[model samples]
Target: MHENEISQIVFDSGLKIHRNLGPGLLESAYEECLFYELSKTGLLIEKQKAMPLVYENVRLDIGYRLDLMVERKVIIDVKSCESLNDVHLAQVLTYLKLSGCRLGLLINFNTKLFKNGYKRILNGDVAL
Candidate 1:
């Protein structure tokens, strides 16, 4: 599926999860549940995947991990903060740049409504 189509599925799943369980839970809770939900849909998703960063010609393991990668194309960053900050956006964008991902979904599960927290980040710097 294209990133747009995959995003609809992921967005629906996130909405369902948020509806089933209100805010205030740990970010990890939402992550695992969302991961399970996504996995059940048969989408390719990697949870807590540790990916190395390469600079120039050296690969470094600096503990940067992707919260979830869907279809190995879109990067999903799960969060439960009161609201998403610049750091969240930067983090996901950085992931997309480093991983060569074209799209990213920054899903924050701390708002009363899922629509209030969904963000689609595109890696315009890297040609898709």
Candidate 2:
């Protein structure tokens, strides 16, 4: 499946989770629920994936992990905050750059309406 398709599934799964659980839960709760929901979709997913930075020909294993990687194509960052901000957007972008992925979804589950917290960040060829 394409990255866009995988992204849509993730978004749908997130909505389902938010509707059932409501808000005020920890980010991990939503993450795990989303992970479980994603699992049933039959798509490949990696939770808390470690991401390293390679600079000056050195592979540095800094502490950075993608919240969830769907099909190894889309970087999904789950956030539970009063609102989604630039930092959250930058986070997903940084993950995309580090992982060499072009597409990502930033889903903040701390909103009255789930759609208001959804964002799609892209880099590389897709950015054009």
Candidate 3:
């Protein structure tokens, strides 16, 4: 499937998780719940995926992990913070770049409405 299609599936799954779980939960709770929802939708999802950072031709086990990778095409970062901030959006973009994925979703499960907390980030100059 195309990246856009994968993104839509992830978004829908996130919405379901948000609707069911509502707000005021730890990020890990939302992460696991979203992962479960995505799996129910028949999409291959990976959680807490180990990501490596290469430096000087040497791979370092820096303990970096992706919150969620959907279909291995889009990255999803789950957040249960009080509010979505610039750092959160930037972090998602950085993850997309590092993972070589074209798109990412920053889903903050701290708002009353899910729409207000979902932000899409695309790689490089690409627009989503």
Candidate 4:
């Protein structure tokens, strides 16, 4: 599936999860729920997938992990915090770069409104 299509499904799943379980939950809780919801759609998803970093032609297992990688095309960074900061955005962007994916979704489940908590991040200078 395309990244945008997968993203739409993710948004819908996130909304359903947020509505059913409101906020104040842990990130792992939301991630598990989201993973279950997405799994039902028959899409391939990797949870807590470890990522290796390469520096100066040397590969290092720096313990970077993606929260969820959907279909190997999009990365989903699950967050349940007071608010998403620049670090979160940078984290997703870094994942996209490392995975060579074009799109990423940063879903923060600790908000009064679900829509306000999600952000679509592009890998490069491409418009959203």
Of 3 and 4, the candidate ahead on lDDT is 4
Q: What tens-digit string does per-residue lDDT give for candidate 3 at 17-69?
A: 88887999999999988888888878788999998877799988888899999
lDDT of 4 by residue, 72-123 (tens): 9989999999999999999999998888899999999999999999999999
**CA RMSD, predictions in order:** 1.5, 1.3, 1.3, 1.0
Best by lDDT: 4
Residue-level error in angstroms, candidate 1, position 37: 0.5
Q: Which pairs of residues collide in model 3? A: none
Residue 64, model 1, lDDT: 96
Instruction: Supply candidate 4's per-residue lDDT for 24.
Output: 99
Runs of candidate 3 exceeding 4 Å displacement? none
Candidate 1 local distance difference test against the native:
0.91
lDDT of each: 0.91, 0.89, 0.87, 0.95
Clash tally, candidates in order: 0, 0, 0, 0
The TM-score-based order of candidates, best leading, equals 4, 2, 1, 3
Better of 2 and 3 by TM-score: 2
Highest-scoring model, TM-score: 4
